[model samples]
Target: MNQNKSGPGTSLVGWNIKSWLSASVNTLDDADLELVYCGSDVPSSQCLSLVKESIPAWQSRAVNFDEGDFFVLSGQQKPVVIMRAKSPTEAQKRDAGLLAPSAYGQARDLVGRAVSEVRKFKSQKVNLRFESCQDREILGALVGLELAAYSYKQSVAAQPAPFPALGLSVKAELKDEAQAIAMGTNIARHLVNSPPNLLYPQSFANAVVELFANVPGLSIDVWDEARLQKENMGLILGVGGGSENRPCMVHLRYRPEGKSEAPLALVGKGITFDCGGLDIKDPAGMRLMKKDMGGAAAAVGTLYWMTQSQFARPLDVYIPLAENAISGKSYRPGDILRAKNGMTVEIHNTDAEGRLVLADAMAVAGSQSGSDKPAAIMVVATLTGAIKIGLGSDVAGFFSTDEALGQVISKRSQEWGDLMWRMPLFDGYRSRLDTNVADINHCATGSYGGAITAALFLTEFAKGYPFSHMDIYAWTDGERGALREAGGSGQAVQCLAGVLQSFGL
Candidate 1:
């Protein structure tokens, strides 16, 4: 965040924040954080609300704890705060150890909430800082939580709210803890929340390219129908056939300073607006389709951090933007469309267009003849009703052929606060998407595992790429938890971003 009279990071220490308070206690000594509590003396539930509500005032000043200083607050005998310094100027480590991981996490929630509250006030400055160790999972998550919170508030039209030019600086080594990830999340959320009128395919592509203009080692490329057709990206072409806006396949790449450790490719489904094509949805259903490109936004957010940060991995992002609107030229259900992979897909559901765009992008991930590719490639898309039905809006659904990759991703997700559930990749479900006339059908014959079926369909074209896909809801509401605000939270950015950093490729 911005520097201020508020004292963001601890000046008492060398500013190396290896740890910080996690909960609210009635007395200063009872807790390491002024606004949060730690033990049974105070319920963590109350602390949660305290965090969300108390964010405003604290932005003007962080909890001031001194190096090696010993102090206690009344009402509870707790070390309300501590400052990590160059020397053994502090001893709250013993006190801090008293609390379990659950309490520590509660503290993270409070800290993140405190940081997020300053979002709307673009004029005044907010200076809140949270301390964390390098390996602490929630450390990065708290940082991301604040960004997600601030970004959510920024999306509101009325957000012209007077808090400050809110800035959050997390003192941690994790990927999401960095400012780049926070800034990128805000930008991606803006892209997702922007109206279709403003964010057409070309404009969106330009926006993604523009996002990398100042960032070192980050680059972008936009391809038109001709480039797609030349490369045999029929799936993207078929879906874009109906839109007047024209389609674009956007590519973004990020290479680290040294030799790449583990190269990773990212693919995002960017259907800027889905009118359902010749097979159209009702006006109500189409209203929120402007966010059909949420996957692209996530990809952009993830790769944005991947490029700008010191992640040792070579990260590349591919986004295929399509606007599925009806025209005489629109591809219809029952019309078999050819994919870049040379597989035929029966148009069981024209509205199932995200997969089509992703199919083309996945097909492009390989060499001209499907030779060399990244060590791993993953796709993100808000592509199905089944995922929504299964995971609900509170969580995301994902399926990966490689269980090991899924575990790593899951670990990062916990750190980033994105809830993801792994569904089955059982081959038995593949039959539901089987079609007689084409190589595969877009939707399953039944709704048994719709999300799994959609994932399977996308996998059909990801032949050479080691790809995993996440079905993100992208929309938010209902909970008032710390740092968790209502609106389009960049659902999976933090998870993959942290994983990207860890993999160093």
Candidate 2:
């Protein structure tokens, strides 16, 4: 493992990764370990023959194996791990593309489990050979294998010895695409896992600059507090006033060669640390506030993948970075702030600060006129606890102004294994944000439908373009599937990347 110091206090470690799909038997011959999948009926003849030759006692073990069970045959030149996978019914196969915990998802998890098991035995190189599998399943398996090797730890003392270099070989052709998506996901995880002291607004901006410094056709711009004040972005400045580190916005533009259509705009809420300001959160609630910037991490990861894969589409990303801390200079609940789009917002609660910074960034995104206007706008944020209550932490909730666009995004999300549910924008909730003193109240009076009201508040600043807002719980609460531990889940990176790739189609 080689650590690359990309920013002031951030280290982006590069994994020694090599993954590809091969059909030839010669490929498996070189691997120290091999994984074979067995359906419910019985192990395949090749698998049985290998088992009998290598370890005859395993024949009875295979017959008694239950679904998701596995047995490792060791003490040979090459070790073999046999996994028992129940064959999916016809109904399961038909509905796999439309539901969570689908066959593809199960395959990914199974592969991830097998890969993790091999790593425990100190096997650095492995091969996975399936008698029969879909391309999507193969892709999932590759992604799972790559992601299973991800671990983030930054210590000043003697660091734990790095995991041995992993070389994964599968039997599919989607290695490049799967590797790109996994890399993007790891990028998000790395950012979200960084300590708050090392990842404030200024350092966050520096990380973005360093990540894309040498990439061609991408321009980066950072707006300081002075520039933000000059532009009258009071909402951003107000929320950031409590912190000495200050608030800033980073705008990234990627333009490919030749004439391109209007670019798509992505706005991310980059609250590096949210102590809930003067309206502070309790100790238990504030323990994981370091992941408050997961939305920005997803956006950064998506852009990084697009540039690396050379996805030829014009795109612009807007990130409003801030820290909602407590101080004498903190913006109060009664303060009314003016957004760049000339709308006044009465602060009802200082804790609801994510939407305030996003309001200004979206205003800037929608400010362009004529040919410069974005074709569509998408905003990503870990915006509300209400969404988690409604959809649970495993599924993200999104609201879109355009029904057709929403449908397309939903389909793309399902295909990529990043689960998202389309929540109603519900114009009926619009009245909740109305206030007597200012143009609108920053937050609703009550907690009812907090997610919907928040989306409605943001819609006011979307400027009538085709808009969608994704409310994500970006932190994984525990170990599950491809995620082997609790940390950043890289929630929307895969889904958003799928949406962008669909644009070119």
lDDT tens digits by residue: candidate 1, 45-143? 232333433344443134333222111222132113221212111452233322112332333444454443333222143333333333353354344
Which whole-number lDDT from 0 to 100 does residue 143 have in model 2? 73
Q: Point out where model 2 deviates above 4 Å.
A: 1-30, 37-55, 63-66, 69-78, 83-97, 102-104, 154-173
User: Cα lDDT of model 1 overall?
Assistant: 0.61
Compared to the true structure, candidate 2 yields what TM-score? 0.88
Per-residue alpha-carbon lDDT of candidate 2 for residues 59-94, written as tens digits (9 for 90 to 100): 446543433355677625677777655555566455
The model with the greatest lDDT is 2
Clashes of each: 29, 0
Task: Supply candidate 2's per-residue lDDT for 313.
Answer: 80
Could you tell me how far off, in angstroms, the CA of residue 169 lies in candidate 1 after the best superposition? 9.3
